[model samples]
Target: MGIADLLSDVWGTFSHPAPDAEAPPTGGSSTSSPAAESGAEKEENKKDAKSDDGGEQGHRPSEGGDEEEEEEEETVDPKDTLEDECKESKECQPAKHHYDECVDRVTGQIDNDGKASEDCIEEFFHLAHCATQCAAPKLFAQLK
Candidate 1:
């Protein structure tokens, strides 16, 4: 079987089946998790806090919690982050090119011979070393 078929079979075996649309709803309490109940309670507490005075919900004005909340909400996609970081590291371009070429060569060999005679370890290591050297300072600076 193809990869997609294999994956689908594996998924079918492990995944829970979805409930039928026409099925009757279970009791209301069956659906809400403990975490969800806690979140709802927190929302009610926040509302109560807001009603106490004309102030922010869940945090006092002087606590500066808004900045932390905003930071937590702003998520960066890992794939895009990696691509952006690598694109900025110009010094690593030559090594990256060499690695790409090596990968292509090996892929072509595999296609023709069902296996590659040589792996791209050397090229991969060279590229990784270059990227690390270029990225470390920038990453550390960001952390600070």
Candidate 2:
């Protein structure tokens, strides 16, 4: 897949709520408003309030669970993973070399000029894209 698609997938995975999660209400009247007056209505309101409060408390633990899962999922540093793949794959060598050269050149330019020019920034992105393309297969494999 293209880098855009891969990035979109990653973002989607992080941004989308869990399948079982109940989305919070977007717009609603306050539950505390003076609406329930009858005895049965007051009892039902109490039950609803208890359930809502319980649901919120229950949801906190699941958030902690998700954090643990995320930690497990991101055990490897992506840059190190890509470098390892680049080292193993001969096809990726040229792109890796170009990327390194670009980085070195940009570094030298920044050191000499005290800032990055537009062209240098553009070249950096180009080299980055090349490196990403070279590492795509192995990176995707690692992600899976």
Number of the top candidate by TM-score? 1
Candidate 1 ranges beyond 4 A from true positions: 1-84
lDDT of 1 by residue, 1-144 (tens): 899999999998679556653777766653235555477567666666668875544533537556554445777755446545774578778888888899999999999999999999999888777766666666766768
By lDDT, the best candidate is 1
> Could you tell me every candidate's TM-score relative to the true structure?
0.43, 0.32
lDDT of 2 at 140: 79
Model 2 residue 104 lDDT score: 84
**Per-residue lDDT over 10-77 for candidate 2, one digit per residue giving the tens place of the 0 to 100 score:** 99989988899897879675556667256765667676667786454221243445555444454667
| Cα-based lDDT at residue 70, candidate 2 | 40
Position 100, candidate 2: lDDT: 69
Sliding window of 10 residues with minimal summed lDDT for model 2: 54-63
